[model samples]
Target: MKAATFFDGIGWREGVVELVDGGARLRDEVPATGIPRLDGVVVGGFTDHHVHLQLVDHSQLACSRLGRVVDLGGDPDVVQRLAVHPVRIEFAGAFLAAPGGYPSDRAWAPDGSVREIADADAAAAAVTEMAEAGASCIKVTSNSVAGPVFTDELLRTVVELAADRGLLVVAHAEGAGESERVIRLGAARLAHAPFTERLDDDQIARQSASASWISTLAIHDDPARAVAIDNVRRFHTAGGTVLYGTDLGNGPMPVDLSPREIAALREAGLDDAALLRALSPVDPLDPDSNLLLLPGSSPAAADPLAARPLTPADLKV
Candidate 1:
């Protein structure tokens, strides 16, 4: 099918892609100006690896140019039901955290969405429950800013349980030193970029050694965005794996490809290739066909516009 590519780094590019069994398969990489003015079906499908689909207006989300979402923190039953739709739903069942941790007080968090665990045994049970309920992975929150965060011992136990269950552990680590703790525990992914504190050399080294950070820079206001950029810069310098994500439902934000988040990544020093890699659905370590396409030559080097902070308008059906 014909398609218009949203080259995340440069401008958008036009091309044709074939969707086989619901996944994109590159058909032909056509030149931008050479895009044939022919008539055919065009599919603009892209995956948002981290999202809280049930919390947001799914109807509004449909307005964005996104094909699917990987719900990082939500109800597994809702996720199971969501999966029956054409827009694929992959997820971590719920937000597993220390008792009285984040999202518990967040007004948007649903009744079953927060799975609070106090100890290692409880953590294991929580992880097992999520798995049995059809979680693609496990999400654990360690946000001291909100309330009591996970203890090192508790975090270790949760990680171990996740490992034993053959599930990837994603942590919502915030507050001083939480990044280091998760890094040391070998978290598979971070729910948000480390915004609470900058990483020390050892911490950065550990972060580089393992773990990937999802970008949710657009959620923060001016000062916070600046802090987030600095944090991301250091992580990038240390060679940490960075993935593009927008905490879609935490507040008002874009439902599709987020340009402001992309701009923040650029400000943090990601170059063309790195930006592409960050936006790419394909894993960088093991290349795959899930590459995003934007139909144009790299745009002229232009002064970066201020962070617009994405809103619903950016998303299109």
Candidate 2:
């Protein structure tokens, strides 16, 4: 066991922890005697909620600050191979889209990364394929501007089938009304903050009640960025859960943590505590949690985004 100052969300407290092969686990109160002590601040594992394994230099992630990453789109085999790379991983196998929906024709999207389900009848086989491929969630697309979007029936079918399999549906909603439809259809998460249009308070309220939005705000420019930020601000204020995501493969952002993404989230009014929550999908205080140790960090939640978790070499028991 090791002892250090730990952050319990609202403030810091002296704590004891056991660093494990996977990550650190919390034990009990701090300032305990007769135990080895690690100097630094301890927090739960950080997860980048949205990423594309086929698009990013994922090799760099082994030494990056993150402890967990969720691949929102990729070839199933590619994503599964990445899961063994030290950091904990969850993935949505491929982008479920209409026959010709977005990313299907994009040069950057490798073949087999987009699963086009033209009819609701194909939904079960699609979900089963991903689930069997070790997928933790299902990604559906509704980008009417790019191509044929999902019919309401198709989206509902996917959502229901995914739910039955105990998976959450993460939707890439880019066109007008697409996000609204995704939210009402019981999708558990939005792949990106809505950037196409500003959401009314009522819509924001409705969204906050059912789904969490991943903040990929830095990927947008101008009107889109501002619109996304505004939507996030209102949604958060309305009690929405915001997950810190970089959309890692979409741009030239850092492979590990993106300061720009953190800045955008700050602009959206997430203070240090909220930022910590965004970084972590599970409570850091739990004994089963994967933890991050930022050496010499005080309890004030200061400069946390700058931390690089212990690399695979350092974390190897």
Query: Which structure among the candidates has the greatest lDDT?
Result: 2
- Candidate-wise lDDT, in order: 0.67, 0.82
Please write out the lDDT profile of model 2 over residues 1-317, one tens digit for every residue: 66667666555677666656655567657555676666567776578999887787778876777778999888897778764345788899988989988879899887788888978677888999999998999999888889898878778889999988999999999988989998888888999999999999999999999999999999999999999999999999999999999998886989877889989999999877788878773456765555677776665655666564533343233
**Could you tell me the lDDT of residue 314 within candidate 1?**
23
My TM-score estimates for the predictions, one after another, are: 0.77, 0.89
RMSD of 1: 6.7
**Per-residue CA lDDT of candidate 1, range 221-268, in tens?**
867677778878888888887877888777777676777787888889
Q: Could you tell me the TM-score of candidate 1?
A: 0.77
lDDT of 2: 0.82
- Runs off by more than 4 Å, candidate 2: 8-13, 17-26, 33-39, 281-291, 310-317
| Candidate 2 positional error at 170, Å | 0.4
lDDT of 1 at 216: 86
